[model samples]
Target chain A: MMEEHKVIVELKQIATRFGDNIVHEKLDLKILEGERVALVGGSGTGKSVLLSEIAMLREPDSGEIELFGEPITQMSGRELLAQRQKIGMMFQQGALFSSLTVLENIMLPIREHQHISGSLLKDLAMLKLRLTGLPEHAAHLYPQSLSGGMLKRAAVSRALALDPPLLLLDEPTAGLDPAGAAAFDDMLLELHAALNLTLILVTHDLDSIWTVTNQVAFLGERRVLMKQPIEKMVKDTHPVIEAYFANERAKRAIRQELI
Target chain B: MNEEKQPPVISESSDGVQLRGEWTTPYLKQLQKISKNNTRHQVNHIAIAQLDPNGSRVLLELIGNEPSAWPEGLTKEQRGLLELVREKVGPVPAQQESVNLLAALGQQVFRVIRHGRELLEFAGQLSALVFSLIRHPRQLKIKMLLDVLQRDGLNAVPIIALLAFLLGAVIAFQGGLQLATYGANIFVVELISLIMLRELAPLICAIIVAGRSGSAFAAQLATMQMNQEVLALKSLGQDPFAWLVLPKLLGLMIVMPLLTVLSMLTGIGGGMFVAMVQLDLSPVEFIQRFGAVVDPIHFWVGLIKAPVFALIIVNVGCMQGLLAKGGAEAVGHRTTRSVVQSIFLVIIVDALFSILFAQLGW
Candidate 1:
């Protein structure tokens, strides 16, 4: 995928505090269109909060969020939603609508975001499901019946249903077996290749960072520790990043656990 | 220190890794079991200690390979649970043979009532939560209602119908047997009519709705609570009550009455079928007698109770769901509480109605 210099989302001096507990402070990042950046950190380091704020799921008390060259912090409810539609997000737990069949899950983005008819939405949903290596029959079946991997794939399919320019995945490979995680990685790569999606993945899964993502960002201590190529990230000398990479458990188990 | 020196030489079965790892060999079985049990026990102790930190004096290592392995929010809570485990277990030895089941049951019953009191109070306070959410309708609220009601309320219809059918059958069979003995088979019509229209119809329907939808409501809100979606909505200048609670309350308020009528109609239909075929009554006479005997006032009374039952079901369901703490287990627990409380409240409301209507010369 060709990297676009166009900054689709930019966070400048972002800070979020939950009462006395300050999650992130003065976090800064520029996500270029068609850039695949994996945000990695400790659990309490506010990776999800960073992603949520950018996604307009949360608003920082201070700092600015610009999506598609528009100031997101200034955008109202209707406008934020309009921006959300253009950006696809795969929730940490797959977050497939439990009420919906896999087909319906995919169709939801279409139903909410566009003017497509139900049948056409179904066809589009099936097509997206296929791209994730899921069969069309998986479409009609509800989420509870699905295996963890199948549910993630269905969510991925749904995320792509609206043909979003930017796709944000929160721990895309978590709760999956190795084969499932690997398969998910392949599916992500395939989607990136096929759609040229500007991907922002918030994950602590180092394996995913190394194997799947192109760029990596580390968030911690109220700031972005680093944002650069994955290769450069692993080679960086930051103590927190070093401690993370040095942890033996991370090498063997943390990838699967964190995903 | 020699025991801890090997870093707990626990090894996974290389082959068993492909499956859920139940594979065992006789030679190494004891070692595996020892390590596995020890690991689980240690984990439990640590988690329990986190829930109730004073339970264990020995500090366990905070043993996550990475930050993601453990819940960040649960450390303090885990300490509290551990400390309470000692409190919960009491000083009584487990080997005691003369343990009183009733006493145990009584303690559980007492705790439940105590818990239930706070819950009912919370149910009353839900309108305040609703009022705060009215100014803004956030996505989280939208998602919660849409998921809970659609996933639970709509999907649970078949099971509710089945339960109503079975309740009707049981009543018809028992009523038929008693009436047969008295040589008053015709009076079974009046009995069935009275019990079902006035009491069983609403009671059974309320129970079914609570069991099915109440639990779902608790789980959905609980998960949202866990994720801070409720907080997120508030931060985004949206009010969760109007967005989430009001619509669901409205939807359930609408759906429950229709369901009550369905239950009443279905129960009667089931009874009528058994009456005609099993008891050898002519269909025309059964219909005419059923029509003649049923008071229009009973129908109104049944309709009237539906909203009250709805209030119980929706209120308890949503209330308990919102009250969910911790993870999936808390959700399940809350769901159970919601259903039980919903059913209890429904019956109590029904009884109050009965008392009031009786005193008013109904």
Candidate 2:
């Protein structure tokens, strides 16, 4: 089933630089449709930067990126809009527009791309809010008033507003409590199953990487060191990958999994 | 697929009206148009050719958000999506129109009162911090104060000088016209010196500082507050006002008087130039007349207002910053309020000062 799936996002020979510092060099990644992939690395590994590059929020210094088979670097802004509509990105800080209520934030992207009646738009936005497990009252509240977990959910709802085929999350469960994080992971799984969404998440949480994702893309040396199931990748003896999973947090997650 | 153009169709079927084809967000308008003609509220059987979240939502809307009427032929995903929309979708609360005049007035009054209370509270706290710091002057952050002084004071010199010069020139040209007519051309010297020194110079300088440094302080502090740096300071057992507000207040207070003096000199120079050109008064004669008639007390009065204006501007800015809630938008809003409130208070205080000066025979 995985072999038959089409590539949703493709990056080849990507490079990112900030002045004299090279963040990424010759980085390559391919995300297939319906696959739950986690981009995991230590801080400064540029996971968020890589996620943004794939989301088309930021352009890599040098790379060829294709979304849904079309090379985005060569695509016109109009063409890119069509491709961009198929991808949704949630930032680490829950970058929901603080000025807008949660429901309005969800409605904005759909309203921009699709001409639906105001009632239908509201219903759709509400459905998105529900799908993310946010309370109905949360729909009317501004992003500022939301708790950390609710804010993340609101951000996810906004990301899912257009029902994008590909969902990208940057640390979706980072600030959430253990139960909230677990519930969020479950919601992601359910959404992925129901919507047939190709999920690419940048996460530091080992539990999220273990439970929410099917494949782990370990980023090290400014590139993906290995890409495989978490079960297999964890066992791999690659020194950088070993060093990453050797942390106390990773051990706790692994221990929990065994039980 | 060419199926993209095939909008959802409603057909009369044995299971009641069957809504078929893609009912996604993009095709919603077309679906609504067709459904409206067909009385889509009767759509009970959802024969899904394709369905997404938006499609499911539109389907629910067509069925009046009643999942009980939904047919059993749907797949688990389709059924789940449809039920999800039906179960969770709530009535969009009507946007509250702020049309009631009395309510609006009441709200405005409450806002002003609340603002005043917060300002008083902040002022009290600030004074307490000042008194405590005064007792331990060695604990003051001199480096931060000097940094703010350089930024808010020295960096503003060129713009202040240019504006003050132009202000003086305009005053001299306007006043010199009437003076020249009445054969009191030399009186332009007194007019320019008195207005520039006693009223316009300090007022204009305060307004400029309010626009520039006042807004900057509000924005910087608001961002810090939003980013939890203010809380972090408190967590570290440091008063945010001592760290953030004091340096700014001291800097502005030190700067405003010096800037006003600069403005006064430039204003007088501008008036001299205008007197030379417009009133046929030479620079030497104008200076001599300025020396003879321009009361030094007017200059003192203007200089005395600077620190007061500075205090009001900095307090308003810091208060707005600390009071800022929400995110980036609140920072912008607070900064605007800082500048506007600073200018308004400065003007009101200036007017009060004018009355006080007049009554005191200053």
Candidate 3:
């Protein structure tokens, strides 16, 4: 089944660094179409940095990135922009523009990329807002006025406005309460199923990993130590992966797994 | 993924209308125009080659929200997407209510009154903190005070000197022309010294400081308020006013008089240069006349207003900052208001000082 699907993102021998501090080295991973993958690691392991690299906001120090089966280094600026329009990235802190209303924030990307007019643009933005479980009233309020959960949902709505097939999230559930996190996980799964999106999210929440992601890419030392389903990843004896999941949450998940 | 696909198109059919092609966002740009122009057909069926959520939404909008209008032969994924978008199609947000003129005027009046009240409360709280800190002076943040002094005071010297010198030169050249024509070129020294020491120096310095340090204080505190840094300091049992607001107020108070003195010296020096070059008066003669004719009372009168201007500037800046409510836009708005209000208040206070000094026969 994996072979049948196309590879959406391929990173080969990727390396990133800041001065003397090395974050990723010789990191190689392939995310297939319609797969929900999570990049999980300890702090400073550069999960967010890797997501940024994939989004083409930042270039790696070395190695090649193949986004949608084309090498990014060789693409022209216009081609890069065209390819980038197919990818939507949501930053960790709901990086919504504070000045624009939530509805306008969602409409901005679509307006820049498409030539749709006034009523159609608003209707499209409103549709995306509803799809992310945001209420109608939220569309008129500024991002600063919304609560934490609503802000995250609003950010996701803006990301989905352009209907990008690939959606990247950074810490989507980090600050949410337990119930909100669970609901967000369900929303992600539903969106993935309905929109057929290939998702790559950077997160540390084990519950979100189990509920939303089908593949877990564990970062350790300076590379992806393993890539497998969460059920299998929890059983791995690798010291880094074991140390990461040693908390009580992992134990409860394992006991409750029924496997 | 970068490959270009067929743009969405609506074709006329006997039954209704047919949407054909990849109905994705990038491709739907053209379909909007086509759909708007097609008046003859009711969109009854959508048999698109490819469909995303955006495409499904456009299709659902084209056909009214009737489930019966869902075309046949839609793949399960496509059907699920259409249903999801259609189910969530809520009414557009309501337009803002139109406010009547009398109510708006009343709101404006109430807003000004509330603003004044809040400013008074903040001023009271700040004064209470200052009084308590005086008894335990060791509690004062010496390091932050020094930092603010270096940034808001020492860093502002160059621009202040340049403006003061230019203003003095303009006054001397203009005054010397009139004084020279009357064969009283020596009185240019009295004119320059009196105005520079008593009015122009202090007023120019205060205006510059209000634009510079006042705006900075407001923007810095407003950004902190936005990021919850002020709240964090409060939660830690530390008074944000004491730590954040007091340093700026005290630093500006300490530096305003020093900057005014610098302004007076540069302005007088500029006047002295113009007198020697343009009025044919020597520096020694100009200094002698300045000391004999310009009373020492003028200098004191100007110096006495520095701290008051500082007080006005710091209070307005910190008040606007602490009251900021939103995000980046609020920070910008508050900072602009801080500068404008400080300058306005400084000029009004200066005028009041002039009247009081005249009545007192200073």
Could you give candidate 2's per-residue lDDT for residues A24-126 as a string of tens digits?
9999988888899999988999999999999998999998998888898888879888778878889999988877899899999988988877877787788
Q: Give lDDT for model 2.
A: 0.86
Query: Which of candidates 1 and 2 is the stronger one according to lDDT?
Result: 2
Better of 1 and 3 by lDDT: 3
TM-score of each: 0.45, 0.89, 0.91
What DockQ does each prediction reach against the true complex? Answer: 0.02, 0.55, 0.73
Candidate 1: where are CA atoms >4 Å away? A1-3, A76-78, A248-259, B1-362
lDDT of each: 0.68, 0.86, 0.88
Residue B44 in model 3: lDDT: 56
Q: Model 1: per-residue lDDT, tens digit, B221-292?
A: 777877889889889997655555666676676677777778787887777777776677665777799888
**Per-residue lDDT of A38-117 in model 3, one digit per residue for the tens?**
99999999999999999999999998999999999999999999889889888888999987999999999999988888
TM-score of chain A of each: 0.91, 0.95, 0.96
Instruction: After the best TM-score superposition of candidate 2, give how far the Cα of residue B39 lies from its true spot, in angstroms.
Output: 2.7
Candidate number with greatest TM-score: 3
Q: Could you tell me the lDDT of residue B83 within candidate 3?
A: 84
